[model samples]
Target: MQVVTTIAGSDSGGGAGIQADLKTFQELKVFGTSVITALTAQNTLGVSGVMPIEASFVEQQLQALLEDFSISAVKTGMLFSSAIIQTVAQMTANTKVPLIVDPVMIAKGGESLLRQDAIDAIINHLLPVATIVTPNIPEAETLTGKEINTLADIKEVAKLLLQTGVQCVIIKGGHLADRNFAIDYIFFKNGQSFSMQTPRIASKNTHGTGCTFSAAITAFLGSGLPIKEAIIEAKKFIQLAITYDLALGNGHGPTNHFAYQNYKETCEVIIHES
Candidate 1:
């Protein structure tokens, strides 16, 4: 089986971070490995606390994994501090593996998962080595220091992000003002771009959407799909995950990570102009 690794935090809530990434990798039929960067005390209601793992230990975990497995792809989620971000960047920078960076900054309950100082580390060190960087609207704004109010704004932010040396950028549009359909715009450094949209489902169980979406892309990439096809499949994966809600938590619940695997045949891809 193709092996993939996630360098991220662990959520006690089991709805996001490493939990969501591992669940996604499993559903996509890839062998999953992980290096935990932090431990979060959280539930569906909210995050109460976070304990960041030491940078040295994070390096050790990655080193041990690198010594053994042939990791086909790697995705990073919540590197809470600049130290940990630097450590992860150093470990993954020279490798030829496809890297998917999920710029996870805040939780659904408004808890900050990334430190204010770590943004520079991510942009300068991590993003330069990333194959694709997935950022939501707010994260994109934070990265580019610009407001994103329209589709044109998203295109501009994507162009700025590509200058960071990432091969591609995916700016998710769930936070945009549109309430009808969820749109995601993908831009490649080669000047190719496209947007995908699906009818927005009115549900509260959307906690781990970004993590799961990026993890699906990692899984597809590990399984030998090209970047464009991997993203297309990942889009379908998340659409099914969100559409078939798990309804487990009191607040923002998680997407059904198994939904895509169970209903792959019927899950259709919707590409539309926003």
Candidate 2:
């Protein structure tokens, strides 16, 4: 089995962050390991508090995993502090494994997950080493210091991010205003670009969608899928997960991590019967 690691914060709510990443990895049939950079006291409603683990401990965890496990790919989310972000960038600097950086800045409940001061560290250090960086509109705006009210703006930001040395930039357009469709733009290092649009699902149960989407990409990459193919698969997976949302919490619930497998099985059965 392919082993994929998540270096992210722990979501006590089991809806996002490391919890969501591990759940997505397992649902995608990959073995998942994790290094908790921080812990959040949060639930469906909002984040109450956060406690970042020591940078040294985070480094130790990564070292242990790298020494023993044959990690195929890695994904990072919610590195809450500059110390954590710097540590992660340094440790992964030499690894050949694919790294997917989920630039998780704010939460669905309007809480800041990444410290404002740490944003520069991520852009300067982490982005250069990333195989792909997945950032939503707000994150892209924060990273590039530009407004993303239009597709052209997103494209320009992608270009700027590519100049920072990342192999690929995927700016998720889910947060775009006045749109019936959620469009995501992918800009490759080779000057290739494309946009994918899916009808925007109207639901509040999208608490962990970003983390889950990035984790799915990491899992597919660990299983040997190319970056574009992995992203395509991950997009489908998140769409189904959101479509089959569990509606667990009163406020912004979570996307169904198991929905992809269940939907695939259901489709197979229908095909066989027909």
Candidate 3:
């Protein structure tokens, strides 16, 4: 089994964050573990409150996992503070596991997730160490200091973000409100780029899609798929998960994590002795 660790926040709504990550791992057949940085009192409506776990506690969780588990890949979401971001970056730097940094800066409800004070540390430290950073339109704007009006703008931002030392950037169009079309662009750190387009599904059950997308990529990489292939498969899986929507919450609902899962595999992830 490919063991994947998700270092992220917890969503009590059970639609986003670590909850969605574990579900995606199960659907992709990877063994999942997690280190929660914070806890959210959120629902379909929106986040009501946040209780950030101690930064030391977050570090300890990662320490325990790194010392005990054979984690093949890691995905992170919603690091709520500079302390948590710093801790994760330092802890992951010496490890060989592929890391997917989901720069979850904003919520589906138009609220900020990443603190402005922590933005500097994320760019200078955390983002540079990530294997890939998945950011939506607004988050990209925040990181790149440019407006994403066209596909060219999207590619440019991804390229600039790549220069930050992340292996690649996947600029998501999930938050595009134009309602005419939807597209996601992937830019490799090697100066290559690709775009995939799909028609917009008019569904309100869109919460946790980002979490699922990042988690799926982590899971695929854990299964030994190459980065591009892993991203492609993850994209397809997330699309199906969104297509087979489970109408649960009053606000944006959750995607069906098990929608396209039909096969079961025994986990065979192995670790080398250091």
Candidate 4:
């Protein structure tokens, strides 16, 4: 089995961060490992607290994983401090494995996950080594210091991010105002790009959508899928997961990671009956 690692914070809510990443990786049929950079006391309603693990400990975890397991691909989310971000960047600098950088800056309840000062560290150190950088609309805006109001604006931000040395940039347009569908722009460093659209689901159970989406992409990449194909498959996986959310919590609930399997079985049954 392919082994993919997630270097991210632990979401006590089990709805996002490392919990969500591991769930998505497992659902996608990949072995998952994790290095917890921080822990959040949060649930569906909001984040109550955040405690960042020591940078040395984070590096130790990374070293242990790299020594014992052959990590095929890695995804990072919610690195809370600049020190942690720099440590992750340094440790992964020499590895040839594909790295998926999920620039998780804020939480579902509008809590800041990444430190404001750490953004520069991620842009200067982490992004240059990323195989793919996944950022939501606000994150892209923060990273590029620009306002995104249209597809053209998103493309321009993608170009600016590419100049930072990432191989591919995926700007998620989930936060677009007054949009009936969620559109995502995928831009490759070599000047190729495409857009994906899914009818926006009207549910509050989208707590971990970004983390799950990026984790799915990492799983596919670990399984040897091409970048574009991985993005497409990941997008489909998230759409299905969102479409069949469990609606567990009082606030923003978590996406159903197993929804894809349920979807596949339903399709198979329908095909057999037909």
| RMSD (Å) per prediction | 1.2, 4.4, 5.9, 4.4
Per-prediction TM-score: 0.98, 0.95, 0.93, 0.95
Best by lDDT: 1
In the predicted model 3, the residue pairs found to clash are 1-267, 1-268, 1-269
Instruction: Give candidate 3 regions above 4 Å deviation.
Output: 177-180, 262-274
Task: For candidate 3, give the lDDT.
Answer: 0.85
Clashes (backbone N, CA, C under 3 Å), per candidate, total: 0, 0, 3, 0
Q: Which lDDT tens digits does candidate 3 get at residues 1-274?
A: 7789999989999999999999999988899999999899999899988888999999999999999988999999999999999999999987878999988877788777888887888888888889989898988999878898887788778878888899989988876766855677888877777766666778889898999999999999999999988887787777777777989978989888887674223211121111
lDDT of each: 0.93, 0.90, 0.85, 0.91
- Tens-place lDDT digits, model 4, residues 1-274: 9999999999999999999999999998999999999989999999999999999999999999999999999999999989999999988877889999999999999999999999999999999999999999999999999999987898889999999999999998789985577878888898888888778889999999999999999999999999888888888888888889999989999999998877844321100010
Model 4 lDDT, full chain set: 0.91
Query: Candidates sorted by lDDT, descending order?
Result: 1, 4, 2, 3
Better of 1 and 2 by TM-score: 1
Q: On residues 220-267, what C-alpha lDDT tens digit does candidate 1 reach at each position?
A: 999999998899899999999999999997899989988887887887
* Residue 7 lDDT (model 4): 97
**lDDT, residue 201, model 1:** 87
